[model samples]
Target: MDFQFLGGASEIGSLGLVVRDQGRTLLFDYGMTPTDPPSYPQPAPPTIDVAVLSHAHLDHSGMTPILSRLPKARLVATPVTLAVANLLTRDALKIARLEGYLAPFTTNDISSYGSRATAVDRHGTFRHRGIEIEFTPAGHIPGASMTLYRGAKDILFTGDLQTIPTHLVGGAESVECDVLVMESTYAGKEHPDRKETERRFRDKVAETIARGGKVIVPAFAVGRAQEVLMALASSGFETYLDGMARAVNSIYLSAPEYLRDSKRFRHALDGVHVIEHPSERKKALREGEVIVTTGGMLDGGPVLYYVGELYRDANSSILLTGYQVDGSNGRQLLDEGTMTIDDTTIRPMCEIGKFDFSAHAGHSDLVRFAESTRAETVVLMHGDRRELLRDALSGFADVILPANGPSFTIE
Candidate 1:
């Protein structure tokens, strides 16, 4: 058996890998680079029988529309991932346009991706030709999953995982495998207890509110938005959610079992203002004491309007609750101690705070996962090198960190 690391080998984005056993071949992910200009990798081989997606993150599943043009390829994913991915692809088509065309795939690709798609749950398994596969909960997003493939050899691919219990998803599944392909999004560091992190987050918000300044929490519209809402509602302050959170929350309410505290989400959301209009967003920024908005990286969202106004005020505070990828306006704000909007660089007089309420496991968690899994050849991907995920896996002699285009024999 042989595996090709097409992308996501030595980087945080565009993770694609192909697993071949005798006459059959299967690929994983198929994402584009998240940075500006949106890096596109080289083309794939002549054919692949199946394309397995573990989640709906742009990095792990973004390139599916691009790759599905390869003849009669089939897509395998969970039901919610398909729903979220369809929305994500449509949005990508709208946003990632170049010269009046989406470089990888068009709206036609998004629509066709659903045609070749099949959904599987935790206990369900599928067989393509001779290879057997299992879908296990990844404990990341609503429908994120871990896949186990067994043929001449056994392999486990963890797309992006979180073992700890969160508001929306269950804890990570401990499904065993012989070759563990895991993501190292958070490594070489310890995370604060979810309870403590939320506690600190509330205290920080309270402090900002006491000083008569509104609090801003910029979040991603996916899983992160739900968690932030739960934290704020339980924090004893009036919290308002704006923009994409309204529409996404409605979808999340459609599937209640996947959440640990569906009642809490609904209860916490009661009386919570859901802002979608621009004037309301500005009014919320001007009047609301505490606000949670999506577009986590602060690239462009209602949060920008809040930050552009509130950031220059020393009494205010901005709370970042998720991972900020490189080149994102979030990182630029965090690193530069200032951000530019409409060509104006505004120095933030507001206190900037961060909480490590990361959904992904840290270094110790990854090691524990590796030791428990039965996989023989472990592949590490995801995360920035500054997180030291690559170095942290050095202790595992079986671990391989593939660069783009590298191929290895899985024997």
Candidate 2:
């Protein structure tokens, strides 16, 4: 089997890969970088037989519509993933237009991709172009998956995996393969213990509320927003849900089986106030409340509105609950003590806190996963600490750090 790393090789975003065997080519995850003017992967081969999407995140499925232009392309992903991808892709197009940038594809292209999509169940095996393919739950987000290809040599692609179970999704299932292509997002980093982290988060919110100050949690609309809602609800807090998260909440409710506890998730939604109008959002801001909004990295969304409103209040708190990529407003706030929203920059007087509510496996978890798989070779991607992971797994397997546009053959 010949594997080519088209993108997402040394960077944390814009993941794309191509696999060729027996005169058939399969593409895996054609995504875009999450930058101001979001760069994309190299042009996809003209005659891709199958394009498999691993999840709904823009960095993993953003460029999928490009494949729609190919006459023989057939898209494959889990049902929920495909649905969420549709939502995210449409949102990306809107963002592109709002930012005055040229979108890579049109709504019609997304529709065409949807028309060509085939939904597969998690852990189900299917044959395509004489190659055996299977998907296992990746535990990163709802419908995120790890793709397994069986040909001359068995290969596994870990697409943004998380082995630790969260309120929304269960832990990733372990699998064995000869060559393992895995994400190293937090390969050498250790997160705070889950229970401790949750306790600290709840305590902070409680303290803010007690002080007659509002607690604003900036989260990703898809997975992190729901997780924050569930966490707050479980901790006996009445929260407010706003922005694109409301739409995602509806989608999550529609697909109950994808979550860890559907009933609990529904209960969380029941306990929260959903902000449906601008007026309602303004009203919520007048009182001391816990509010969760979209745009986790603070790139844009209702978070900007909340930040602008709360920045001057020293008693108010803004909690960031995810990884802040470099150059994002979230990172700027954390590193430089200021946030830029549009043309205006503000140094908020509010208390700022960052929590590790990440959906990726940490150092110990990555080591456990690597040792469990017992693969002969482990290829690390999607992170900057490849050397750390290589050193950690040196005795367990042969480690290979690959760059973009290179082909590695598995023996």
Candidate 3:
């Protein structure tokens, strides 16, 4: 089999992988990085036979809409992934227009995707013209999956993975394969204990609220926002939620089978207030003790509005719930204590903090997961520090660190 990456072989975003065997071509996880101007993977080959999506995160499903235009390409994902990806891709288009950047696909393309796509269950097998792929749960978010392609050789492709269970999802389980293609996003890093982290996060929120200040939580709408909401559930904090996560919540609620505990999930959301419209944002600001909003990196969305209004209050706090990509407004705030708003930079007087709520496996966890897969050959992708993982895995399997745009044969 011949393997190649269109992008994201050496970085954390703009991921695309192509595999050719027996004259059939397959693509996995076409994505784009939502940066300042945004970055995309190289255009997919028009001859692709099948494309599989692992999840709804922008960096994994961002570029899937364009695949609708390919004559021979058919897309596959779980029902929940398809629904959430539809919402996210449309929102991405809106953001591109608002930011004045040209979008690669149109609403027509997104609208056309359903006709060319098939919704598979998390435990289902997809077969198209002799190409077979099996889906397994990937713990990053609800409906996230890892695919094992049955071809000239059995190849397992992990999109983004979390080995430990979080409040929303269970831990990812390994499947046996001859070749393993894994993500290494946290290759050189280790996360803090999740329970301890949650305790500190709740404590900080309580402290902020006790001081008569609102807690502004900047979270990613897909997974992070829901996780934070569940963590704060049953705390009687009078929390309010804003942004596209409200839509995602509806989808998740409808597809309760995808969540770890559907009943518990429903109960957790019951106490939180949902802002139904933009006009309600001011109300959320005025009445909420804890405001959970999106654009986790503070690059855009309702989060910027809350931060703008509360930055002057020394008693208020902004708690970040995910990785702040470099060059993002959140990263600027963490590094320089200043953030850009409408091209003007200002310092925030509010308390700032970050929590280790990452949805990817850490260094030791990655090693252990890879070891469990028992693959003779391992290919690491989707991380800047892939070499660290390569070194750790070299003794167990032949490790290959492929670069974007290069094809290598695996035998």
Q: Model 2: number of clashes?
A: 0
Measured with C-alpha atoms, the lDDT of residue 40 in candidate 2 is 85
Each prediction's TM-score against the native? 0.93, 0.97, 0.99
lDDT of each: 0.78, 0.88, 0.93
Off by over 4 Å in 2: none
- What's the CA RMSD for each of the models? 2.2, 1.2, 0.8
Give the alpha carbon lDDT tens digit for every residue of 289-395 in model 3.
Answer: 99999899999998989998999999999999999888999999999999999999989999999998999999999999999999999999999999999999999
- lDDT computed for candidate 2: 0.88
- Candidate 2 local lDDT, 1-411, one digit each (tens): 777888888888889889888788999898987589878887888889988889988888999988889999889998889998899899999999999999989999999999999999877776765867899999988888998888777778889889989999999988898888889999779989977898899999999888878999999998999988888886666688888888877887888888889999998889888889877888778743888998898889888898888899988899999999989999999999899988788899999999999999998898889888878999998888888899999898999998898798767
Of models 2 and 3, which has the larger TM-score? Answer: 3
Evaluated at residue 184, the lDDT of candidate 2 is 94
Candidate 2: give the clashing pairs.
none
Error of 1 at 198 (Å): 1.0
* Candidate 1 deviant stretches above 4 angstroms: 98-102, 384-397
Highest-scoring model, lDDT = 3
